[model samples]
Structure formats: C-alpha cells, structure tokens
Target: MCNLYTSLYVAISVSQHISVYSIGLGPTELLLLTLLAIILFAPRKLPELAKALKESADIIRREASGSAEKSSVEDKERALKEVAEKLEASEKQEKKKRRFF
Candidate 1:
C-alpha cells in the first residue's frame, strides 16, 4: 500500500515538474521510468492506475481547452459589441449633420 502511494506520488510529481519546467525526456527516459514503475508496483495494478491517471489527465485537458475557447468567444463577442457601438455613434453623428444642413 505504501509502495503504491509512493510510486503514484513520484509519478504525479514527475509529470507536474516536467510540464512546469518544460523538461524534455526522450524515449529512453520514459521507458526507464515505466520499468521503474513496474518494479515498484504490482503488474496487475498498473493498468488500473494508468487508466485512472489517463482519465484525470483527459478531464484536465478538456477543462483547460474549454475555458480557453470560451474566453476567445467572449473576446470576439466583446469586439463585435464595440464595433456596433461605434457604428451607432457614427450614425448619430450623421443624423446630426443632416439636421444641421
């Protein structure tokens, strides 16, 4: 049980550190890490642990991408609104000019 937790912690920490620091580990390092995980944990546990981690990662990725898309849409809407407001102001100015003439 302790070994499982320790290995999982190490895996999560390594993943976070890699992403945060942009550490580039090649295929050999990844293979070694996978083998180390297998050595640390039961073979049967690996699939289940990998599945859980994959699901968690997917959820986080979807959420981040979704929020980014949402913000971009909001920015587009804001820009459109600003353009509309400027057009309306210009129309008012045109009307004022017509009334003056």
Candidate 2:
C-alpha cells in the first residue's frame, strides 16, 4: 500500500514539472529534511553522509541505464533474427515451387 502511494506521488510530482526527488522528498520538503538533519548531525558528518548518498545514487543510475541499453540492444537483435528466419522460409517456399514447375 505504501509502495503504491509512493509510486503515485512520484508520478504526480513528475507531471507537475518537478525534476528532482531526494529520498521521497520534493525540493521544499527535502530542504526541510536537510535542516532537520543539520540539527541532528554534526556539520562534518553531514558532508560524509552527502558524499555517500551521491555515490550510491550515481551507481544506481548507471546500472539502471546500462540495463535499459542492454535490453534495447537485445530486442533489436531478436527482431533481426525473426526477420531473417521469415525471409529464409519464404525463399525455401519459392525454391520448392520452382522445383515443382
């Protein structure tokens, strides 16, 4: 139920033209959360946490894009294979017809 709600929330935010999401928070909300974090953590600690978050987000983005590219390439290869098989079958049929005549 919460997962569905998060998905819907992100979808709505995207349609409304917000381009950034930070761990389920919109920009304004994220700012508020950051303030709260500052109150809770040391200034030095905040930079370390931010660096780790940025690295993880980068890794996730890279993997997601890589998988999407791989899937598209695989789809194109499969389509070409199917077309080749179809052409080969058609050629075989034509050869059989020619042989009979």
Candidate 3:
C-alpha cells in the first residue's frame, strides 16, 4: 500500500510540472523566434521584405479611407434629399390648412 501511494504521488507531481510547462511561453520565446527568423532570412532581405509589407499595408489603408469618405458623402447627399422632400410635404400641408381655415 505504501509503495502504491508513493508511485501515485510521483506521477501526480510529474503531470503537474508538465502542465505548468505547457501552459504558454513568454517574451524569451518570442525573442528566440525573432532571432531564428533573422538568422534564417539574413539582414539584407529583411529590409526589402519589411518595405514591401509596409507598402501593402499603406495601400490597404488608403483604399479603406477612400471608401469610408465616399460612403459618408453619399450618406450626406441622401440625408439632404430626404430633408428636401420632407420640407416640400410640410409646405403642401400648410397650404391645405390655410385653404381649410
């Protein structure tokens, strides 16, 4: 019975340690990954790749901004048309009221 208890305790302790280890990594892991990537790609190619990525990101941002601006302008035009229609309808109603009175 004592030997069984000892074995169970050792197994539980080892499992707990493994769970803690597998939980997640921290900044050291990220730094190691960056270092590995740098070593694999070298310094010269990294700058060109980074520039291309930045350009692509800028293009996407510009397109998104332009679409947002265009939609806002369309929204404003629709709102103005709605206001004009409402004003015309109210003016007609006023004329009818005057005729009735």
Candidate 4:
C-alpha cells in the first residue's frame, strides 16, 4: 500500500509539472486543427481560404502601419506650428523693444 501510494504521488506530480497554461496552441494541437480543417473543407476551396486569410492579414498590417505613420506626421506638424508661433511672438517682442529705444 505504501509503494502504491508513492507511485500515485509520483504520477500526480509528473502530470502537474507537464501541464501548462497557455493561450497559444502547441505543434500537436496545430496539427490536429489542420487535420480537422482538411476534413471539413474541400480541397479546391483550401487555396481560396488561404488567400482570403492572407489578404485579411495584409490589410490589418497596412492599417496598423498607416496609423503609426499618420501619428508621426501629426506630431511633426504640431511641433512645426509651435515653433512658428514662438518665432512670431519673439518678432513682436523685438518690434516693441525697437519702439521703446
């Protein structure tokens, strides 16, 4: 009974160590999902499905990159406007100083 208990404890510990919490699929899971996809979808339709997925990924990437570029351009424009405003203010200060002198 002691030996049986030790074996059970070892097995439970090993299983617990092997278990993982993850949001992403491992290779075996991915392979099974691929097999399931093959069984459910037609061979002729696979290419079209793959193409649609690629297009969607590309569109998402483009939108993300475009937003980054847009923000950068906006930052540059804001900085330029600030500098122009400061320049105008300094020019006005210089003109007032000239009038007093």
Candidate 5:
C-alpha cells in the first residue's frame, strides 16, 4: 500500500543524493579516466579544464557533506517521529482492548 510507496520514495530519494558527490570509481579507474582525459584534450587546455573540474568537485563535496548531512538528519528525525506516533497509536489500541476485556 501507501506506506510501501512512501517508504520506497524516501529510500530512492536518499540514495540518489548518496551518489551525488561520487562516481564510485576506484583509484585505478579514476587514474585511467584522468589519463584518458589527458590523451583526449590538449596539454595547454588541461590546466584550465582541471581547475574548473576542481572547483566543481569542491562544490559537490561541500554540498554533499554539509547540506546533505543536515537534510539526512532531518529525514531521520521525521522517520523516527513517524515510528513514535505509530507506537503511541498502537499502545492506545492495546489499552482500549484491555479496558473492553
């Protein structure tokens, strides 16, 4: 039901952000990629290209570590609040059952 969709939505949203700052490439793979970029582009252009890339990476790193952590903390708080509400509701039901019996 609705809860399943909600859970999936939250999970997918979080995971998309999890990879925002990373390509998941290992050191060897990253080395190869850099080598390929060097081969494909001119040496003179490489420094400018690298400077732009570094700036972009710094922005991404800052966003991921700082803003993302804050949002993730809020999401966790929201989820925990939901669970607490559910538990409280269930406890109320149990109390009603006891009173009826």
Candidate 6:
C-alpha cells in the first residue's frame, strides 16, 4: 500500500544521513515544497496566518493556566473555611459546657 511505502521511505530517510539518494525526497524537495506553498499562499498572507495561529495558541494556554490557578485558590479557600467553621463550632460547644457546669 501507499502508506506502507511512505512509512518505509520516512524510516529510511530519517535513519540515513543526508545523502544523494535516501529512497525519497530530501531537503531540496522540502525547500521546493516550501517555495511552492509560499508562492501559492502569498508572502503577505503567511504572516497574518502565523500571527493568528500564535495568538490562538496563547489564548488557549492562558485560559488553561488561569483555570488551574482558580481551582487551586478555590480549594485552599474551601479548606481554610472548613477549618474555621470546625474551630468555631468547637469553641461554642466548650462555652456551652462551661456555662452548664
């Protein structure tokens, strides 16, 4: 199948050093492909696309980090609140016992 051939070509290409023939295309082919893509997409469009991709990635990263920080803060607040409530309840019980005696 074509996939098998492609995988084998990739494996041989990566394992071997940069030579004249490594079963498939090489850096020259990559350069040609890049040039073709640039020609097709236009140089002006590339920067805009790259900037959009970068901004989207940054937004995703920032949101993930923000949510994680928020969750951690919430967890700490809940723990402290629970501890305070327990202490207050214990103090109230002690006061009641003292008054009863």
TM-score, per-candidate, Cα-based: 0.72, 0.73, 0.58, 0.64, 0.45, 0.55
Residue 88 shift from truth in candidate 2, angstroms: 0.9
Q: Rank the candidates by TM-score, best first.
A: 2, 1, 4, 3, 6, 5
Across 8-75, the per-residue lDDT of candidate 2 in tens digits comes to: 34434332342355346566775565666556766656655555656666787789899999999999
Candidate 6: minimum summed lDDT over ten consecutive residues — where? 11-20
Off by over 4 Å in 2: 1-24
Distance from true location, Cα of 89 in model 2, Å: 0.6
Looking at model 3, residue 58 earns an lDDT score of 64
lDDT (C-alpha) at residue 54 in model 3: 51
Give the CA lDDT, 0 to 100, for residue 101 in model 5. 100
RMSD list, candidates in order: 6.8, 10.6, 17.0, 14.0, 17.5, 13.0
Q: Candidate 3 on 5-100: residue-level lDDT in tens?
A: 443344333333332334474545544644554557545554454456456656866898999999999999999999999999999999999999
Of models 1 and 3, which has the larger TM-score?
Answer: 1
Tens digits of lDDT, candidate 5, 21-93: 3677555555565566656765555555666666676787898789889999999999999999999999999
RMSD of 5: 17.5
When 4 and 6 are scored with TM-score, the better candidate is 4
What TM-score does prediction 1 earn?
0.72
TM-score of 4: 0.64
Cα lDDT, model 1, residue 4: 62
Tell me the spans in candidate 3 whose CA falls farther than 4 Å from its real position.
Answer: 1-37
Tens digits of per-residue lDDT for model 4 on 13-89? 33233322342555566446545654575555544554565566568668989999999999999999999999999
- Give the clashing pairs for model 4: none
Q: Model 2 lDDT vs. the true structure?
A: 0.65
Cα deviation at 92, candidate 1, in Å, is: 0.9
Ranking by lDDT: 1, 2, 5, 6, 4, 3
